[model samples]
Target: MSAALKIEEEREWKQEQKQERISPVTFTTDRTSSGATVYNVNRDYITHINVNLSPGCASPEAMDQMFKHIHATYSTPSLSVTRLPRTCEPPSDQITTTYLAVDPLYNSAILSIAEVRAMIGILQIMMVNPMLCSSQYLPETLADLKRTMTLMELAIRAYRHTDLVHSLSRAISIGVEQCRGLLEELTLNLASYRHSLASGALNLTRKYVWARAGQGSTMDALDYKLRKSHSSFAACLLALGYAAWPELKRGQLGKDTLDELAKFYVELEQESTSLRHIKVDTVIVQDHLGRDLPVPMIFCTSSQDFHVVIAGFCSGLAGDVLIQRGNYRILNAGDQVIDPKDFGTLFEPGMAVTMSILFYEKVEERQGIEGYSCPRCQHVNSRCTGWVTCAKCNGSFKISPEESIVSPETEQHADTDFIPNERSLFRKISISKYAPTSRRAAAAAASPAIANMAPSEPLKTENALSDGGVGDVALDVDDIELDEANMVEMNANTADVGFGEETYGMPFYIREKGTTNYLTSNGCRRAEGTQIIVHPRKNDFEKSAQVFYIDSYGALYHAASGLAVDIVDDVPCLRQLRPVSGRPNPWSHPLPEFSFINSQIRVKFLSDPAFPSCTDDLYPNGSWATKTFLLASNNEKDFHVHPISDFSRWIPTSDMEDSLSYDPKKRSEKTLRVLVERRTKDVGGARTSWEIVPK
Candidate 1:
């Protein structure tokens, strides 16, 4: 090669190196011969540097050191760096700078990279020193911390836009490390008051008796401080996420570090912010998909009243349905104290129920925003001016209430118990039969005269016993003695006087004097002359039992019939009273209204020769839908009545299987096959015993 050619190549290489040394901060994309994009550096133009530092951090010594470092790093004549003095006096005490052209949309706030680094450095100095982290310095420190984070976010955002995030890598790394340090310091601070930060009753105790006069106020202050600290800590974490985006994006942060940050974010969102609330431990609730929810209910107990905060089917965080049902109580564990009225009677020791304090996210009205947020559906209505109906849920709400987004009553009734059939309270049963005919019949079958008093079906015989002569069956003399307590008082002398107010007693099964039978309402048929019958007593006979209330004449009136029980032709029947005046005076003296009184034919049931009879034929043989049980008598009569064991009396079989197994899902599926056996003597059980063995 010629010496002249070698010299030309060498000069070109030297010129390229000199150009790279004083490269422009900004660059333009150019296409190379190979068709690959290349960023060209224009070194002829000098890049100006602006350094804006906080007033408290920018001492003369600090400025000189910073200047020396900048001058040493960028020694090329093409670079011009300047440090603005505090005397320049920006608009406010707040230190700000603007980065131009990096973000074509808007100039980045905290203009220079130098200002961001300075703010981060100041935060680090204050964080490291224990004395500087005192209570008096917290507020100022938090404000600065948030401000620095915002500036960092803007810088990172600008760099990202210009595809120059790598240029701020070092700054990003330092800022993240400082964030972690601040988080650690804040965590320790919160830990110092962990007990107070936890949710519970903040009552004055003997330990704080010395400061009793100021205890309430002290507790209030502490609560506020703790909440504020938490808020600041959360804000710091949020800022860290923004500042550490470059590292997070490139996977520079370790899995553990990333996981820790993610966990913190999740906890921040899940943690309840309410002052005093208890978490439900065992949720007997299941969602629509049949998943168990740990904290399915939110209840608030104020004064003596308790109501649900959130319940029923709701949209979950991920859009899956969260179906919660039933009432829940917070069970106080160990030394914990909960108000008796709010919870209930003291839960027995080792009661599987457990509880923890809960917090709630209080819904507040949004301000300075162009939308009205629905408290119910959380749908935003940006176009609404005053009262508006939510497009999503069709729920109506005022633009914003005079005081709150939701009224107190509206909140309480938002998600309550599901009422079946009843649509509007104003609609009466007589006018509309919205309830299904099957439900009415099922309900009537479950509890005879309680719902739908006017029976739609005829009386059916319960047992295949003869309606023969009562004289055929022998009666025991001792058992024939009637208890005076069971008899209703009938004072003919005071019949004219009124019993100021009506009185009713607990519903009872009226057992006849000589038989193991009760006075049963044949059916809820409102025919005037239907005679009440005597049926063999079964377990839980409240469905067939009677409720008696005292009338104005002190006479016992059957609540279902609104008539007094009287002996008409030697039969117990509901009888309408004869009116006193010829015109049936409306208001001479207020009397009970008698709508109809037809002398309908009566029903009679004679004692069966076989005292206790079988009801096997009575079972709906073809209907598998109806729950069936067999209650066999020990005497071989083989009575197969529906067995509903009153767990209070039955004993477990010698095989040692638990007969008291309860499963909420399969409630109708019986685990025990009970046999009603009569014993002459107490061999190992009661005379009228139920031998219940696992089915």
Candidate 2:
């Protein structure tokens, strides 16, 4: 936007203006009052992923544990790729022979780019998504993926959170995190190739070719560039490795053939850096002093209508950008215009935001398969959306993508990647940003104070019924079936038991969708140290939790604690309060007779419309604490407790479609989908939705 800026300097700004375009088609829909239309604000082109995670726990420590589990279980992270030689070439004649040993690497690097694209950008896509890491990775890539995933799974397994959704989410998240390295590594490879190839051109020109004032020198420079920058095996054979093309056209090879090859390589290099790669001075850091830090960084001149990002740098061009006022526009990264949801998807609601320019230099190498040739499929410049399925062995690969170019042992120099140990993860847990998106703050406006009790002398079973709650008797958990259509609902019958019955028996775990943790308990003890917690599934998690529901008033009696979670205040922990003959306790919303949500039950205690808001208070401390309800026993000594409330839910352990067992190794084609909502109202579109694959 600066008036005195060079046309190339202003190119990025102009390019962004061209990218802000209108779509081919538009549709209109009614807006909702519950919240904004967060689903499709990116318009028709962008995709949406919503996680309606709301945790249920009384203790701040317990809440913290659940949140920690959610992040630990499901999060994506950026990974650094293998480092390479930094001795890049400059445009000038100054050449450093000190890096001569790394010269052959220039040829290897160009081939490396092609191979990465063939693997990830091509063949790998034929595996599953062919775009993400998993069983789809080439054998070598698969080994790396397994290392990362095994660590993630081992981390979650060591904990006691038992929610089905969390387990699946954590598994998929690990794949996403590891897959990031693939694209990043590709970019780095291209950067190295660009630098070395340019350097090779400069070196070839200096050693050969005469410095004549006129004719041959210009042709020599062009010929040197083609033989180095974009040279393939075919090009080398055509020029016979000649640095000067004087042997080209008028000398020996036809002029049109040499001229055409020269023009092609130059155009390819220009198109490669079509997007500007700019680096800013250190003054503009991504910080909190005064700038919007959560959103994707944008670049533009103060006066330009468009925006751009520092994609990569060229020491040769001396920061020069390729610009022709491009013929068409782009949707930019993520294929969407700048919007608030991009940042909202990152941080918590109401977190302060500041907008400012970014200072770091952005760089990218050609990582995608759009322009690379596929080795197996013999496809030229494969344009598949991350795909190149094979004909014989399907998508199987016998070699690693890196090894295809040059095996690790064959390389002149190599850098090793850092591997993490499982034991170290237990001592220090680290979860990334994406994990929190599936969870929401469980704090309310006013939290009831739970009383802290001291450990009392152990009590006998006879005294357990002193609270006048229903006594818990042993029941067969296996009697429960994954199929809801054949099973009898609590309201199925009459005088003996069923729909109008006074009491109904059910055994299940209440899982928090956001944290993927379960409501756990160690039963109630008469001692002062008896309090419950709401957290994750661990090695010794209680599988049989028999809950007695008093149908008339919704009194949820915990079989383990022999006490009902009251909707009362002044209780420090979830179980501090006892049930009385007062207002109905927490309620349960039964799923309608819909075949889709067969055996699902939603239990919401906090934030229920029938109850007054007194769960959270802006305590003097900078933290917001809210009262939570769950079945737990006090243990200031690593005590585990079960979370109870309307927010908690229980479904069959089997796949949602009943097509496979919960622990089966194979996946079924049928989708195991579950519908969730903030309230148990009409079965319309809910704010949250989830899919479960028990395996």
Candidate 3:
């Protein structure tokens, strides 16, 4: 062979030897070394990262999802079989090559500090060029940013606790540098913009200003929002820096590096403190970025300890706003140390500042209740009574003829003995107390012999109540038996109170608070979608007007029908616990449970855990999405029961004529729908409250 040919062959041989040396390393956990459970690491962590999510997002679930994605993606092996030539045909139907196995137990972990850096990059992009994101996803992106900062502070704490401070100091320093760069870039950009306008390189037009007025606000407002966003971001970075102080000071670093870190943190503290004196345009920030995510939030951190307050608020304080130098506690707007329990319970997590603002600003009106005044002394009393003894004047007088101050409506129905608006709930009252006050009176009036009988005389009835109400005199409010064992023992399966029919569960009257009205089903109908309404108690006991019960899951179910109470189109209606099963759509199914809030005074529907797009864990509101809405109905279908997830089908089908109608007679009204108010009030008043009144 020629010298050139020989050289080419030698080069090819060397390339093959290099390929053999660089082949993938494989291992198995087997002690015998048979290699039956061999595994290979593909190093495809990037494929595990979700591209759809903004790189800055770092919630615990997001981190866990990233890990799961990596685990699932890495376990699948690629096919690289080499086919043999037909000429080598001793038994030639097959092809052969090397096969590598993947480990099913393999999982990957990511550095939390890397996630923090990604968050900084995204925030920089948002501050510099927010237009790159669509308008709808802006809120989600801001939420991601807030979550990222929270995780960063938590990771720093973990590093200090786990003795990883020395190893993580380099990454923490890099993150701090990135944050400093971001602050500098934001400051320079704003300065350059102002300088260009001052130098006459850029000019504002009247039309431009007017157009922006309709859009939101002026250019100055935009500048304010940008500045606020920058300050808040800086405050967060400063907090993280303080949290990682132990890690930062772990190694023997050069004087220049230490000085640089100290200078950056000091500058951040100044910016954060200076902006605190200025009134931040919180409304604009909320509108642009979203509430609790990136408003004028304050983060408290300490250097001596791993103390970091996530979204703690500070108002009207002097000096070093970012660092909690001494107290190491989160202060609320009231300048009081916040309780730890308030984090995810009272207000949303990382939303103490926003909630405080709304509580002080938006809640302006107070609910008033009118009280009865004494005719002689003019002393106001909470409840009306026939006699009143004034505490201030020490005078006594008769206020009304009826010794007990009952409403006129209640007096008219007194002979029927209806218990209206029994407010003290969650307590057991005996069956004798729950019995109609007029039942004994009516029985006495029916027979003169019974009226003439002595007070101690033992009267007889076949199916008397279980609470020893066999023969009892008319009961006064004070004479009623309370402090009983339980409602189930006192009233369950009893016949004396006139529950001849079987009840599904513990029967109770859902009465409007401070009123003589009760939540009644229209007529005694057994229809699936019977309209639930508030109406005056009737003399005759009807199953429709009598009973409602709460199930184990907090769903209020009408005893007459097995259906549960749910709000559809803002109207309370009866719906099946579960809609028709096996439906292709899950939203077409009604949510299984409803919940009570504020001591069972307020009721709100709960989302299904299995519902599509429903988050697995609770968010800041203690729920996925729950907000208050007015209770009103414009059309009959508004009261129609539908699936909880079927919110799209709740549009009213009423005509314009019906919607615009003002005449009460012309409107197709059967029963009055329950009016849900923002505040609760007393009974016998126009604005009444609700109570769980037992039968």
lDDT of each: 0.32, 0.26, 0.37
lDDT of 2 at 308: 16
Compose the digit string of candidate 3's lDDT tens values, residues 25-140.
44432333222233332321111111222122356466557555545654343455222222224534322222211111000002333444465465545545432222344344
Better of 2 and 3 by lDDT: 3
lDDT of 2 at 531: 33
Q: Report the C-alpha displacement of residue 690, candidate 1, in angstroms.
A: 71
Give the winner by lDDT. 3
Residue range 593-687, candidate 2, lDDT tens digits = 11112122222232222223344431222111111122212212221122233222332222123212111011111121111122233221222
Residue ranges of candidate 1 with Cα displaced over 4 Å: 1-121, 127-133, 136-286, 290-695
* Number of clashes recorded per candidate: 2, 54, 6
RMSD (Cα, Å) of candidate 1? 37.8
Candidate 1 per-residue lDDT over residues 10-61, each given as its tens digit? 9977866665475334321112211111122343322233443322344657
Q: Candidate 3 — worst ten consecutive residues by lDDT sum?
A: 356-365
Top TM-score model: 3
